[model samples]
Target: MKNIVAVNDKKQLASFIDFPHDLYKNDSNYVPELFIAQQDMLTPGKHPFHEHSTLQLFLAYEGDQIVGRIAAIQNNNHNKINKTTEGHFGFFDCINDQETAQLLVDAAAKWLKERNMTSMIGPVNFSTNDICALLIEGFDGPPVAMMPYNAPYYQQLLENTGLAKKVDLRAYKFIAGDYNDRSLKLTEAIRERLKRNNIIIRKINMNDFWNEVVKVREVYNGAWDHNTGFVPATDKEFHYLAKDLKMIVDPDFIYVAEQNGKMVGISLSIPDINQALIKIKRGRLLPFGIFKLLWYKRKIKGLRIMALGVLDGYRKMGIEACLYGLTIKTFQEKKYDYAEASWTLEHNTMVNSAIEQINGKLYRKYRIFEKSI
Candidate 1:
C-alpha cells in the first residue's frame, strides 16, 4: 500500500529534507543543502517567503519507507502581479517508479487546483528568485550556489507526467588561464568607448551598502524587466539573500556601471558558497555548521557571476565586456582557478557570448518546465 502524507511535524519535515541524501547517496554530483538553511526556508516565521506565499510538503511512503517528496507552492505575489493563475511544484524527488512520481505530482496539482489555480509550472522551490530549474545537462559536476540539480531520469519522469519544457537555462565556465584573450583586449576599448560617454565602471561601495543597495535595486528591477518570468526580488528576499552573500561578497567583483553618476549596469560575482554548504550536513547550521562555513569562506575557489545587467539604451556599449573583464581581472589577480556565469536563459545569446568572448566554457545546463492543468 502507498500513502502520501503532508509534512506537519519536525520529524517528518526533517525526513522530507533528508530524503535527497538517501536518494542521491551514490551520486557524486549530488550536494546536500545546509539542513538549517532548508529548515529555516521551509519553516513558517523563519523565511519571509512564507509571509506572502504558502507551500505544502508531501512525502510518499510505501509502508514505513519513504519513496518521494514534493513541495506544492502557491506564490500569491506571482499570481497577483502577473495576474496568472499558475502554481508551482518544487523539491520534487521520487524513486524510479511511475506510480510514485505520479502520486507526488498529482498531490501538488490537486492542491493548487483546490486553490483555484488554473495552470501549473516549475520545480521552482520558492520562486525564480531562488533556484527554479532542473539540471538537464552537464550533470558531470556539482552545482554552484543557488543552482538546482537532479538525476537525469527525473527529466523523463517529469515529462511522462505531462510537464513540458518551459525554457532552458545555461551555465558557462571560465578557466582563467586557458581563456580567450580577444575579449580581454576588446574590454579595454569598450571601457574607452563607455568612458567617452561619461559611463564608468567601478567597484560597489561596501561602506555605504544600504544606500548602494537601493540604487542596485533600481537597476536590477529596470534592467531585467524584459526577461521572461523575471519577478522583482521582494525586499525580504533581497535582504535574506544579501545576509547570506555578505560573507562572500568581494567589492572588487561586485561592480556597477555608472554614467554621470547614474546607475546604468550592475554585475556581481559571489564566491561559490556551495563549496561550504555542501559540508553543512543537510543544510544544518548549528553546532559546527557555522564554523565550517566561516572557515571555508576565504578558501572558496570558484565564483558565480550571479547578476549582470544593463538597461535598454546602454546595451552593446561594452557594459557587458567591462563586467566580464573585471571578473576575469579579479580571478587572475587573486589566482582563483575558474568562475561560472550562470543560469542565463538559453536564448540570451548576447550575454552568453559576452562571457564566451572571454573563453568561458559552457559547462552545465538547467531547465524549467511548465504544463497546462
Candidate 2:
C-alpha cells in the first residue's frame, strides 16, 4: 500500500532529503549532495526563496519503505511577475511505477490548485536558477556540477502523467582538441585588443569575495533578463549558489572583464566535480564517504562553462569572444580535458552560434514541461 506523507516536520524533511540517497544508492553516477547545504536550502527561515515562494515536500511509502518523493512549489513571485498562475512540481523521484508517479504528482497538483494556481508547469522546485530540469537526455554519464540527473524511464513516467513537453534546453559539448582551433589561435589577438582598452581578465579576488559577487550579481541579473521565464536571483539565492561553487571554483577560470574601473563582463567555468561526485554514493559525505571526495576532487578533468555575461552596451565588439577565449585558455593552462556550455535556449541563435564557432556540438537536451489545469 503506497501512502503519501507530507514532509511536515524535521523527521519527514530529513527523509525527504534522504530519499534520493537511497534510491540512487547503487548507481555509480550518483553524486551525494552536501547534506548541510541541502538542509539550509530546504529550511524555511534559512533560504530567501521561502520568503516569497513556498514548497511542500511529499514522500511515497509502501509500508514503511520509502518508495518515492516530490516537491510541490508555489512560486508566488513567478505568478505575480509573469501574470500566469502556473504551479511547479520539482525534486521529483519515483520507482518507475505508473501508480506511484501518479499519486505523487496528483498530490502536488492538488496542493498547488488549492493556492489558486490555474495550471501546472514543472519539475521546477524553485525556479530555473537552480537545478530544476529533468534528465530527458544525456544519461549515459553522471551529471555535471549543479545539473540534474535521472533514469531515462523518467521521460516515460512524466509523459504518462500527462506533463506535456514545454521547452527543450540543450547542453553543447566540446572536447579539448576537437573544439575549433580558431578560438585557440585568436586568444592572443583578443587579449591584445582588450588590454589596449584597459580590460583584462583575471581571477576573482577571494579576499574580497562578497563585494566581487555583488558586482557579478548585477551583470548576471542584467544579462539573463531577456531569457524566457528567468527570474533574477535574489541575494540569498545567488550567494547560496556562489558559496557552493566557490568550493570548486578555479581562480583562473573565473574571469572578470574590467575596463579602467568598472566590471563589464564575466565568464565562469567550474571543474566538473560531478566527475568526482559521480562516485559519491547517493550524495552522502559521511561515514567514510568524505575520503572519496577529498581524494578524488583534484582528479577531475571536465569543466562546465556555466556562465558568460556582458553588459548591454558591451555585448558586441568581441567581449563575448574574449571571455570565452580566456576560459578556454585557462582550461589549457590547467590541462582540463573537456567542457560543456549548457542550457542554452533553442531560440538563442547568437550564443548557440558562438558556441558552435568554437566547435561545440549539441550533445544533451533537457525539457521543461507545462500543462493547463
Candidate 3:
C-alpha cells in the first residue's frame, strides 16, 4: 500500500528535494537541480513567493520507501488578480506507476479542496513567472537554465490521474550561424525609423544594475499582462529572480528600448548554466562540485533567449526585431552552438511568427495540465 505524507520538517523536506536525483539517476538527460537552491525555494521566509502565497509539499511512500512527490500551491496574488479560485501543482516527480501518480495527485487535490479551490492547474511550481510546465516533446537532451524536464511517461501518468491539457508552450531552436539574418539586415533601417519617434534600442547598463532592473521589471510586468496565466510579479519577486539571473547573464544579450529616456521594451538572454550544472553531480556546489561548475561554465556553448518583451503600445515598432537581431549577432560573434527561445504560449501567434522569421525551428513543446476538483 502507498501512503502520502505531508512534508513538515527539515528531514522530510530534504527527502522531497532529493527524491528526483535517485528517480532519474540512470537517465542520461536528467540534470539535477541544485540542492541549496531547492532548499531556499521551498523554505518559508526564504523565497519571496512565500510572502504572498502558500505551498504544501507532499511525499508518497510505500511503507518507508519514497515513490513520488508534489507541491500544492495557493497563489493569492494570482487568484486576487484573475478573480479565480484556481490552484496549482508543481515540482512533480514520480516512478512510472499509475497508482503512485494517482496518490500524489489525490494528495495535492485534497489539499486544494480544503482551501475551497474549485479547480487545479499545474506542473506550475508557483506561477508562470517561475519554472513551470512539463516536457511533453523533445526529450533527446537536457533542459536549459530555468527550464523543466521530465520522463516521457510523465505525460501518461498525469493523464491517468485525470489531468487534461490546459495549454501547450513552445520552444524554438536556432543554430548559430544558420538562422536567417533578415532581422539583422533590417535592424539598421528599423532603428532609423524608430528614431523618428524618439525611440532607441540599447544594451542594459550594468554599471547601475539595480536601477536598470527596476526599469526592466516595469516593462516585463506591463508587457506580459495579457499572457495565459500571467500574473504581475511583486517587486520582491522580480528582484529575487533578477539577482539569480545576474550571475549567468551576458550583458550584451540584454537590450532595452527607450522612448525619450522612458523604458518601453526589454529583452534578455542567459548562458545555459545547466551545461555546467549537469557535471556537478546531484547539484551540489561545495567541496569538489564548485570546481566542476567553475571549470565547466567557461565551456558552455549554448544560450537561452529567456525573455523578450515590449510594452503594449510599443509593439510592432521593430523593437522586437532589433532586440533579436542584436542578440543573434552576439551569438554569432561568440560562436555559440545554439540558442533556444522558449516557453512561448502556443496561441501567441505574433511572437511565434517573429521567432519563425529568424528561422527558429519548433523543437520542444511543454504542457500545463488541469482538472476540476
Candidate 4:
C-alpha cells in the first residue's frame, strides 16, 4: 500500500535527502547537492530560515520502499512581507508515477491548509532566495552552481497534480567569444560619469569582508525589494549564506557601487563549483571525495553571475553595465569557457534587456507553480 509519512528522525531525514540521488542515478546531467549542506538547510536549528518559519518533510512509501519526498514550507516572512497566506512545496522528488506525485502534493497541501494557508506556490525550497522552480527547458546539460535541476517529467507530474505556472525564471548563457564586450569599453566612461555624482564602482574589499558584507546586505535587501515574492534576508540569514559563499568567492568577480561612503549597488558572481561537485559521488565529501573536490576545483571553466542588483535611485546610471563589463573582463582574463546570468523574472524587461545587450542568450527556463489550497 502507498503511504505518506512525515520525516521525524535523522534516518528519515537522510532518506529524504538521498532519494533524488537514487532517482537520478541513471541521468548523466544530475549533480547531487552536498549531503552536509542539505542536512543543515533542512534542520531547524542549523539554518536561519527555520528560525522565523517552519517546514515539515514528508516521505512517500509503498510498503518498505521509499517512492518520493517533499517539504511543506510555511515561510512566515514571505506571507508577512507580501501580505499573502501562501505556503511552499520544495525538495520534491518522485518516480514517474502520477499516483506518487499526487500523494506527495496532497500531503504538502494538506499540511499548509492546516496552517491556514489559503494558497500554495513552489518548488520554492523556502523562498526565491534559495534554489527553487522546476526546470522546464534546457535539459541537455547540468545546472550551474546553486541552481536547481530535475527530470523533464517533473513538469507533467506537477501540472497534473493541479499546479499551474505562476511565473517563469530565465537563465542566460554567455559563451566566451559569443558575448558582446561593448560594456568593457564603455565601463570606464560610465565610471567617470558616475564619479561626477560621487558614485564609484570597485571590487569587493576582502580585507574588510564582514564590514563589506554588511554594506552589501543593505544594498541586497533594498535592491530586490520590488521583485515578486522577495522577502528581505534577515541579518542572520545573510551572514549564514555569505559565510558559505566566502569559501569560493573571488574578489575580482564581486563589485559594489558606492556614493561617497554608502553602498548603493552590488554585483556578485561565483565560479561554477557545480563542475567540481558533479564528481563528488552521492555528494559525500570524505573518503576520496575531498581529494576529487580539491583536484577538480581548479579545473572549473564557468561562472554563475548569480546576483546583480542596483538600488532604485541608482538605476540607469550605468552601474549595471559597468558591473557586467568588469565581470566579463575577468572571465575573459581567466579564459573561462562560459558564464550564466540566471533566475531573472520573465517579466523583468529592464534587467532582461541589459543582459541581452551583452549577448546573454536565454538558454534555460524554470517555472514556479501555484495551486489554491
Candidate 5:
C-alpha cells in the first residue's frame, strides 16, 4: 500500500531532500542540488521566505521505499501583491507511477485547502523569483544552473491529477560561434547616443557590492512589477540572495545603466556552475566536494543571463541593447562555449524579439501548472 506522510522531523526532511538523488541516480542529466541550500530553503527559520510565508513538506512511501515528495506553500507576500489566495506546490519529485503522483499531489492540495487557498499553482519552489517550472522540452541535455529538471512522465502525472498549463517559460541558447555580433558592433553607437542623454552603461563594482546590490534591487523591483506573477523581494530577501550570489558572480557579466549617478537599469549573467556541481556526489560540499567545486569552477564554459531589465522611464533608450551587447562582448572575450538567457515569459514579445535578434535559439521550454483546489 502507498501512503503519504508529513515531513516533521530532521530524518524525514533529509529523506525529502535526498529522494531525487536516488530517483535520478542513473540519469546522466540529473544534477543534485546543494544539500545545505536545500536545507535552508525548506527550514522555516532559515530562509527569508518563511518570514512572510509558510510551507509544509510531504513524502510518499510504499512500505520502506520512498516514492514521491512535494511541498505545499502559502506565500502571503505573493497573495498580498497579486490579490489572489493561490497556494503553490514545488520541490516535486516522484516515480513514474500515476498512483504515487496522485497521492503526492493530493497531500499538497489538502494542505493548501485547509489554509483556505482556493487554487493551486506551481512547480515554483517558493515564488517566481526562485527556480520554478517543469521541464516540458529540451530534456536531451543537462539543465543549466538554477533550472529544474524531471522525468518525462511528470507532465502527464500532474495533468492526470487535474493540473493544467498555467504558463510556459522559454530558455534561449546562444552558442559561441552560432550567434552574430551585430549587438556588439552596435554597442559603441548605442552608448554614444545614450551619453547624449546622460545615461552611462558600466560594469558592476565588486568593491562596492553592497551599494551596487541596493541599486540592482531598485531596478529589479520596479522593472518586473508589471510581470505576470512577479512579487518584489523584501530587503532581507534581496540581501540574502545577493550574499549568496556574490560568491560566484563574475564582475564582467554584471552591468548597470546609470543616469546622473542614479541607477536606472541592470543586467546580470552568472557562470553556469552546474558544470562544477554535477561532479559533487549527493550535493555535499565537504571534504572532497568543496575541492571539486573550487577546482572545476574555472573550467566552466557557459553562463546564464539570469536577469536583464530597465525601469519604466528608461525603456527604448538603448539601455537594453547596451546591456546585452556588453554581456555578449564579455562572453566572447572569456571565450565561453555557450550562454542561456532563460525563463522568459512566453508572452514577453519585446524581450523575446531582442534575444532572437542576436540569434539566440529557442532551445528549451518549461511550464507552470495550476488547478482549482
Candidate 6:
C-alpha cells in the first residue's frame, strides 16, 4: 500500500534529507548538498527563514520503502511582500512512478490549502533567496555550489502532477578562453568616463565586511526590487546570508561600483565548491569529509557569478561591463576553467544581452512551476 506520512521525528527528517542520495546514486552529475546546512534550513528555530515562514516535510512510502519526499512551504514574508496568498513546494524528489509523485504533490498541496494558500508555486526551497527551480536542461555536468539539480524526468513528473511553467531561469556559461575581451578593453575607458562622474569600481573590503554588507544590501534590494517574485530580504535574513557567504567569498571575485564612496553596483561570485562537494559522501563535513573540503578548496577551478546588480539610476553607465570585465579578468589571471552567471529571469533581456555580448552561452535552464490550489 502507498502512504504519505508527515516527517515528525528526527529519523524521518534524516530520511527526507538522505532520500536524494539513494535516488541519484548512479547519476554522475549529482552533487550532494551539505547535510548540516540542509538540516538547519529545514529545522524550525534553526534557520532564520523559519522565524518568519513555515514548512512541513512529507515522505511517501510504498509499504516500508521510502518512495518520495517534499516540503510544503508557507512563506509569510513572500506573500506579504508580493501581496499574494501563494504557497510553495520544495525539496521535491520522487521515483519515476507517476503514482508516487502524484501522492507526494497532493500531500504538499493539501497542506498548503489547509493554510489558506489560494495557489502554489515552486520547487523553491523556501524563497527566491535560496536554491529554487528544477534543472530542465544542461544535464551534461554537475551543478555548482548552492544550485539545484535533478533528473530529466522531474519536469514531466511535476507537469503531470498539475504544475505549469511560471518562468524559466537561465544559466550562462563562460569558458576561460572562449570569451571576447571587448569588455576588458572597454573597462579602462569606461572607468575613465565614470571617473569624470566620480564613480569607481573596486574590490570588496574584507576588513570592514559588515559595513560593506550593509551597503551591498542597499544596492541589492534597490536593484532587484523590480524582478519577478522578488522580496526585499529582512535585515536578519540578509545578515544571515552574508555571514554564510563570508566564509567562502573571494575578494577578487567581488567588486563594487561606487560614486564618492557610496556603492551603486555590486558583483559577487564564489568558487564552485561543488567540485569538492561531489566527493563528500552524504554531504557530511565530519569523519574525513571536512578534510576533503578543506584540502580540495584550493583546487577548485571554476566559479559561479552568483549576483551582479546595479541600482536603477546607475544603469547604462558601463558599470555592468566593468563588473563583468573585472570578474572575467580575475578568472583569466587565475586560470580558472569557467564561470557561470546564473538564474537570470528569462525575460531579462538587458542582462541577457550583456552576458551574450561577452560570449556567455546559455548552457543550463531551470524552471519554476505554479498551480492553483
Q: What is the TM-score of each candidate against the true structure?
A: 0.95, 0.94, 0.99, 0.99, 0.99, 0.99
19-52 per-residue lDDT for model 3 (tens digits): 9999999988889999999999999999999999
Q: Output the lDDT of residue 233, model 4.
A: 95
True lDDT of residue 254, candidate 3: 90
Candidate 5 regions exceeding 4 Å error are: none
Give residue 360's lDDT in candidate 4 (0 to 100): 96
Candidate 6: deviation at residue 260, Å? 2.0
Cα deviation at 117, candidate 6, in Å, is: 0.5
Predicted candidate 4 versus true structure: per-residue lDDT over 1-373, tens digit per residue: 8999999999999999999999999999999999999999999899999999999999999999999999999999999989999999999999999999999999999999999998989999998989999999999899999999999999999999999999999999999999888999998898899899999999999999999999999999999999889999999999999999998888899999999999999999999999999999999998889899889999989999999999987888888888888898899999999999997999999999989999999999999999999
CA lDDT, every model vs. true structure = 0.86, 0.84, 0.94, 0.94, 0.94, 0.93
Candidate numbers sorted by lDDT from highest down: 5, 4, 3, 6, 1, 2
Cα RMSD (Å) per model?
1.7, 1.7, 0.8, 0.7, 0.7, 0.9
Name the lDDT value of residue 193 in candidate 6: 92
Candidate 2 residue-wise lDDT at 114: 92
Candidate 6: the clashing residue pairs are none
Per-residue accuracy of model 1 over 1-373 as CA lDDT, tens digit each: 8889999999999999999999988887778887777888999999999899899999999999999999999999888878789999999999998889988999999999999898788889888878788888888788888888888899999999899999888999887688976666677888898899999998999998877887888888888777767777788777787777776788888999999989999998988887877776655677888898888776888888899999889987779878877778777888887788887899988878777767788888887888877
Query: Model 4 off-target regions past 4 Å?
Result: none
Colliding pairs, model 5: none
How much lDDT does candidate 6 score? 0.93
lDDT (10s digit) by residue, model 6, range 1-373: 8999999999999999999999999999999998998888788888888888899999999999998999999999999989999999999999998999999999999999999999999999988888999999999999998899999999999999999999999999998899988999888888899999999999999999999999999999999999888878888889989988888888999999999989999999999989999999999998999999989988999999999999988899889989998898899999999999987999999999999989999999999999998
Candidate 2, superposed: residue stretches over 4 Å from native = 195-198
Error of 1 at 46 (Å): 2.2
By lDDT, the better pick of 1 and 3 is 3
